[model samples]
Target: MNENPHPTRQLEEAPVHDQFDVTLEDADLLGEVELTTNLIIAASESDEHLEAEEIDRILGVVPSPREDG
Candidate 1:
């Protein structure tokens, strides 16, 4: 029932990386599945979904971008 008789016939490894990694995250993860490679925003539940507008409203100040803009 094995498609490939030999394991050494892997044409590629790790697969191709998509140019972008855009994702829509929800605060309430009630019935959601936890991916092993998900970009977890915060360690605590109280401080989640770090959107720019949300961040500014919370901290009462504009937050610096983590990555170079």
Candidate 2:
């Protein structure tokens, strides 16, 4: 004698770990990821193309020597 067409299912709660370790390298990588994501967003919004120097600056990359002179 069930009137409801669907029945609710119960979900088990997952245990939470209060203690977590963060390394300096992990933080640096996270910062780099954030910066890259922001750059991608800005690039997608802009109509103009990004210059090589600008790209290098945003990625913190050193510009290599161009042989095509």
Candidate 3:
């Protein structure tokens, strides 16, 4: 076994923000997908009444999707 102060593997810090993808798609279903996952958050009209996109189209209101129970 190697016991050295220097790590055999390198670690990266302060990653470049541009390298991350932050685009939301239209067909993304609100429930299954997490808003904070994959550095992207999708927003669209809420199916409050199950009408689908009839009203209240999501537009970064909360940076996450809210499903009605």
Candidate 4:
């Protein structure tokens, strides 16, 4: 018993992007932030060793807090 009567309806139309406006650069930045956050969380939870490049990438995405303000 399928709850959605038109299961394939979503596939027939184009994707709707009315929720928010995000440029390509913004989208890429968001993706990097998301990946870095996930990696940081995973590293904190497990004892796995992160490669030098991975560590650099994660550090690059995280913003440093202001000291003066």
**Most TM-score-accurate candidate:** 2
Q: Highest lDDT among the candidates is held by which one? A: 2
Q: What lDDT tens digits, residue by residue, belong to model 2 across residues 1-69?
A: 767777787889898765665444687789988888978986998799988777777777886778986
Candidate 2 TM-score, C-alpha based = 0.42
Instruction: Estimate candidate 1's alpha-carbon lDDT, on a 0 to 1 scale.
Output: 0.50
**lDDT, candidate 4, 21-68, per-residue tens:** 755568778887787788878689767788766676666655467899
Query: What lDDT score belongs to each candidate, Candidate 1 first?
Result: 0.50, 0.80, 0.44, 0.72
Which residue pairs collide in model 2, if any?
none
Location of the lowest summed lDDT over 10 successive residues in candidate 4: 55-64
- Candidate 3's displacement at residue 44, Å, is 28
What does candidate 1's lDDT look like per residue over 32-68, in tens digits?
Answer: 3342122243324445555656544543466676996
TM-score of 4: 0.34
lDDT for 15 in candidate 4 is 82
Ranking by lDDT: 2, 4, 1, 3
- By the TM-score metric, which is better: model 1 or model 4? 4
Q: What is residue 11's positional error in candidate 4, in angstroms?
A: 58
- Candidate 3: list runs displaced more than 4 Å: 1-17, 35-69
Please give the TM-score that candidate 1 achieves against the real structure.
0.21
